[model samples]
Target: GSTMSQSEAAMAKANPMYNSIYSQLPQYFGEQPWTAGPVYVGAFVMFLFILGCFIVKGPLKWALLGATIFSILLSWGKNFMGLTDLFIDYVPMYNKFRAVSSILVIAEFTIPLLAIFALKEILSKPDTLKLKENRGGAIATLVLTAGVALILAVAPGIFFSGFITTQEMAALKQGLPAEHLAPLVANLTEMRKAIIASDAWRSFFIIVIGCVLLFLYQQRKLKASFTLAGIALLCLIDMWSINKRYLNDEQFVPKSKQTEAFVKTQADEMILQDTTLNYRVLNFIGFPGNTFNENNTAYWHKSVGGYHAAKLRRYQEMIDHHIMPEMQETYQAVATAGGQMDSVDASKFRVLNMLNTKYFIFPAGEQGQAVPVVNPYAYGNAWFVDKVQYVNNANEEIDALNDILPTETAVVDVKFKEQLKGVTEGYKDSLSTIQLTSYEPNRLVYKTFTPKDGVVVFSEIYYPGWRATIDGQPVDIARADYILRAINVPAGEHTIEMWFDPQSIQVTESIAYAALALLLIGVMVLAWTQRNKIAKKS
Candidate 1:
């Protein structure tokens, strides 16, 4: 919630052991380590990017230059941690984003646009010596771009050593017991050197080719038509050939393979048979990444896991503190019990049960059937808690969740204290019951009969959009158990409804429609004026 203080935001962003540098280590990008550090913008663009600085002029040139420089700095990925930290700490929504190197796309885009302008300037004024700016631009582009290319071709390792993924891989493997890794690492090191040298040579050749064409055009030895065609063809060849190394024909799979990707496996078919409304499935088979970071499980059932880099901060906190640790504990228990998960007590995994994880998908058996392990203690849609445990801050609130029994108690932040004023002192009675009468995407109805006013915690994730009502009278919804919903109900049988009414959306939609109508009217008026002018001229 936005109610989290500045200190809490900082706490949330803090990672003492992990940073941009640490992320280059193996498995950081999970099976795709090459994605960790990539700076390739293509050889053609590299030459043009450097040349554009000298040739391109005016406010647009300065804008392009500024964008290119800042993006490159940001692509350093917190090698400038002080500056990056400031953005994360103070700048709105900056801290929420990631993949620092993604900023290079700005440089990539602006470079090509500036390069086209640079090319136009050269083509329009072939005689470099005619204008002082043209002559200066030509000399600068050649000396700087060609000279750097020459150096890169000769000493490729000097500039790029820090960004090498192979070095990180070697360091990571050295700590393990793999005897074969020594030779593999050695081979990879050689391959890395070859790739670096090849890229450098290729870029140097491309730059020389471009410089020669421009020089020839200036000397009148080649026509403008020939020069433009040569440059265009070179750019196409350079970009295409280089990209082919990464994305080639061999990478394409058969139609059957593509079809098989989404084809519901026997496991999925089996799980779909359970017509229960609200329960999550945990699919461990084909789990290459962490459970929550895999999306395939979601296709067949309400998976207890999913993949999203920008998931809600509070939910991620729950995953770290509650879900992951509980999952590990459950795995350890099953292993200890000789892989018989049924022998393990479901009560021990209080958090998982509260999440309503009813089924666990295991690997295929001898008969090629997906094994489904059922969790018996899964707490359904909503449950009446015995008490409410309130904490002063988010950190304290999340910390309190570690000790409490989720089914019996709810850990709530103190910010929601006003709404929970009446039921701060909780009640628990066998006669008091709450049942989910109906469920819809936006609305949930519950029939409740309580001897006295008490708090009922819903398994559904709490969001600001959700509004609670006790017989149509609006009541506040408290964020409980770090991410779930909780509301207080008065004594006696009552009809309770919770609706996801994101009220601001309605206002935004109306404004959008009004703006569209205004735009249409303006367009019509402009078209009418243009038509009148044309008619008068005729």
Candidate 2:
């Protein structure tokens, strides 16, 4: 029942949007308003025009020099490092605004440089510097930088960090219903990510912005024409560097789409609708990011991968073939008692076995109470259904899991469990393998209620020494106790994972050795090359 229509679910996806004067008056003007991309492009072009004036030997070259100094300061202080991730906590919609603003900055540099390059090719002179004074260009740059800084400072929180949170509360009060507000808040955060991509579009915006400002100066009254042209060249270089990255491929969907698709598919395959199937088949081939198929392997774990894998594998072996020792034993007893096990029953078994083709419905009971195993995927806690039998339930010959036929003198084959040897390389003889009672996708969970005797070993056979912590406190844990580590945990839940140690012989040693070797080789090559070059010149 916890389901949504496709269109309704799509609303939850991230879509970041920002507005400017153009957007506000767009209805009347019809598409003249500049978007975030254009603004960034414009800014970059303006920056380069300032740069070009300084490089060329011309009047107001001092002003061009001043612009260069300002560009460096603004680039680092106001642009590059100015966008901090911490603002999201203070400003309610700061994340969304930040993303779009960042993109605009890139566009500022890209578009201007492109125009400058085109003009140079048309003139057929690659190296020429001619510039005159652009009266108000300096003031404009200063004003833009100052405005951006002010916005950063007085944004939601000027006095105290706590005030930012307070402003958020006040803003939300007069808006949508409290229930609806949470979803919107979540959506805004996602939108921020879309606008923050470090890609070509951003570069394009920066160049364009720089060009427009220079072009303004080039107008006779404004003067500095040649300087603006040179600045455009610099913007072009930056833009080309940015766009060249995506020259090969085009059809790239956001990674977020793939992750969502995988989760939805898993959810759909988990509902139970039938109760007579024994075997389930899981095809893990198509699921993205290393999803395990349910048919080949099965195990008990809270993860969907484990549950589906186990259920389908068990169901297929038992129900489809009807050759499992347990089923064959049960059938022999019923047949001896004069009930014939016919081809019809075998056909029903086949249908039931194949129910894992998609997924079956399973019933959940109260916490701690054991439910009948309806789904082979979800066992122990729920009643599962064999989807195949659900459709053919009216057939009187259906020997469902619910039907308890009498058993004959059939015996179960005993499989002896073997003790595994430790895989630790150096001290294999000293360490013992720990028995895992349960496993999650990324971890194996084991319980040692009491500490094991004999040097308390944790045998691990991985390269790069792992970190060992006692109750989350870092300790001087060594590789010796890697596999069967003896540690004291509280009687409740305990977590452990193989942690990487950089100082050990695993990673750091190799890097250090490689560095030393490279240094020595470089010195030898330099001495030989210098001696040969001098001899040849003589």
Candidate 3:
């Protein structure tokens, strides 16, 4: 059965048009603090909280404290190793902010204190912990109800992680970019918005729980021993199961289309590198392989992407199989000769994008397996070839080789021009345009065009840097990150090209990213410092 080639799949993985958050998971893992340690620490922390909860009195307060601690442990574990799919099943809302380990830690500290404050009101009421004679039955019912509810909440998470859905399986079969699953991939970007909703829900739950306990205190119906141990126990079990899962799988695990895209991408890169004159075969060539003097090894690497390499490899494999033993020597010689010529040819194409040649030649082998290589020239090397040899004789693979292409084919010269036209010729009601002044790497300036009434509508300035503004106004520039940005004008018209500021944009981005990193580092450092400062003050 034929499967889509890795090259085809590469188009998908190389550009993750959507499902970008899935890409961030790896980056988040790299940034997590706990990645340096064994993940089992979370499990250990869970055990400590469980033990502390059961051994302590004031069960609601203790249970709240335990939940807070357990959540923190789970958050860190998920953040570091990317162990989080199960959280999506049970507490889907939590999964969105799981990477925000520091925020979750703050929540853990705040939630328990809030629960304790709520507990204080209830316990201070008369006979809050005291149980009535018939209340044993009520307590038992509450315990069982809570335990069952807990199991219901937890079981789905444990089961869902073990299997992939039919959709994911289908994506793998389709190959790359998961074109069939594009819609699903697109949804991943909106996960942060979904996460915000989850946080609001958690806030609602906390408020409801606090209000109920406060109401009981106000009515004098609060009991000290009125504990929901069943609910607390269920929470403990669920938390423990989640911790166990995290401990078992600490890898940055990808799911569905994410996994398929990642795996296929790796496979494609491997094949391209192996088949082409990449890092493996052409260690001598600089990147883009456009040197004045060509390296044979680099030529071999560049040639692999062309038609010749494909046919050469096919013919060589055929010869190896003895399908055509007598033809092996001639085919091998031709492959070697073509490879040598291609190296020289590739340099000329590297100089310019337009002049880049795109054809290759492969002489026919003794067997019928040989095919011609096409697209021999790349950028800069377009017109560099002066002479070429072809196999014309049987004895000398060189002697047999022939150069059918004319000398002009050796080098290519390409010219591109843009003509300007009269502004009134294209559009009516147009008036005289003002002169353009000043240019930055990504920003350009021009005078606005006014109609006969002197009302300006458009401008006549060019943005070679990518963006142009008129009358100190900004224009929305797309593809500003690309190497070139050009604005066209019609023939017989006046136009000016000015470069905009790219360095400023790049510097701004670099500084902002650095500032963010420093800010995070500062926050963690400050938190630890404050803890020490408080300890000293105490």
Candidate 4:
């Protein structure tokens, strides 16, 4: 549930902290990273990486170096945000990805490749690493690694005293008194410094030991096999020691604590009773922090708001413009009116109803059980809106959602005008109706009876790869209500179905079959070869 909220996402252009790869206070300084990042390649491997740079031969070395350098620079992400922004703007498909530091996977691959090849060079030609420049390179590598560690270990404050960001300071100040906040900040900063210093010493000691072994092997004081074994042992110890810090016995909990973890609250019970096709649940549970970050609501119901990395960009846009503004207004009203379910203006939930949010679970009462508040004006699974309000741009389209009632109108982007095909005008009889007859994650079946040509809006999230059919013939589904699907339907009783059948699936299937056939052929050939070899030996 770490998906960035619409507010934070909107602010991302001005603030780099909201970017996927930007490090945070509790994460970078914490003992264990929240994203399971800061991938450790081991101290010994890193030492070999530096030594390998000088010893590795040919263009392969340069390729590996290039890969290493590319990954490192890209991994800086928001730290050197200009490069990241340049890639996002100019590089094709670069804008589609997040978690920029994940590019370090390339460095991980290249580092090992160079390290192994460099070791091979030394084993094959004993005097290779003994050359003046190569020896100096090796010495310099040790000096650089150890020297930096020594400085950081001795005086970390000199480099990172002012590490706290405005965001971090603001977050820390919450619920903290003026006198106490300073000491807390100081202590945390000291601890962060200590953590870095500790790790620096750890890296320094490991590298020194590795260097000592290399010196011994080069000078004929140790056997080649012993040197290899010692290096492998050192890498194991370093990795194991670091890994144990994150994956330890403390993570285990008692059976009682684990059992019934997703037990239903009273709200869940009330919500589960509603046997409708589908409806989204809202459990902001009285706080903005709970808005999109809590997944507990999703445990038993389809949530209107929940965190996920791959949430639809269109939905995010809707959140930024429609949902967030409406939510803030209602929450503010609720706060002013004394924070009760009755204080909530059900009328203000235009965006919410359009999303078909039926139940809002609030934590209340003596036992603190979830209290379910039914939104009576929920738009249901499907509806026939009176008109399609077209807008010039994204901003206009989103803002238009609030301008008119979502129950009567759908604000659509002008980009989708081609799909509408000059059929923007709509008319739905008050008696005319539509209901979701069947609902599946990928397929939806709806029954609609319209008196005339009208746009039937389904309370389903708008995404690519969905194909709409009226009775049997395929029809274009237009982007409607900012984050919903709507199709122009002819009058009379008809079955409307929408199914997800992405074209990419066909290509993927072909690739899978080809790979399978190749694997089978390889297996058969290998079996035949083994049989022939066994016969000859016999």
Our model 2 lands, by Cα RMSD against the true structure, at 22.8
Cα-based lDDT for every prediction: 0.72, 0.34, 0.34, 0.76
**Model 4 scores what on Cα lDDT?**
0.76
Score residue 387 of candidate 3 by CA lDDT.
26
lDDT of 2 by residue, 195-285 (tens): 2222223434454454454454444334455555556566566656534433324436678754443442332333233332232333223
Tens-place lDDT digits, model 3, residues 58-137: 66655577567666656655454444555656764664452445336554454545434534433554333343632353
Judging by lDDT against the true structure, name the best candidate.
4
Cα error, candidate 4, residue 170 (Å): 1.5
What does candidate 4's lDDT look like per residue over 1-538, in tens digits?
A: 1222212222232234223322323425422224743578887787777888887768988999998998889887777888888888999988777578678889989988888787777766667778987989887777777777778778876665464556667876885677767765655555456566767888889888987887788888888899889988998999997777567676687888765566877778888998887888887574577678767778789998888877778887777777877777765665465555565676787888888888877666666567777766688888877778888887787767766887788778888876766566777777798888888999999888977888777888877899988889999988877778878888888999999999989899999999999999999999999999999999
Q: Count the backbone clashes (under 3 Å) in each candidate.
A: 1, 72, 59, 0
lDDT of 2: 0.34
**Model 2 lDDT at residue 338:** 36
Q: Candidate 4, which segments miss by more than 4 Å at Cα?
A: 1-34, 78-93, 248-259, 332-344, 366-368, 529-538
RMSD of 3: 21.2
State the weakest 10-residue window (summed lDDT) of model 3.
411-420
Off by over 4 Å in 1: 1-41, 55-60, 129-155, 160-178, 240-259, 286-290, 338-343, 364-369, 534-538
Query: Could you say which candidate leads in TM-score?
Result: 4
- Candidate 3: regions farther than 4 A off: 1-149, 152-154, 157-162, 171-376, 379-484, 487-538
If scored against the real structure, what TM-score would every candidate get? 0.81, 0.22, 0.23, 0.87
The true-versus-predicted C-alpha distance at residue 168 of model 4, in Å, is: 1.4
Q: Runs in model 2 with CA error above 4 Å? A: 1-116, 119-466, 469-520
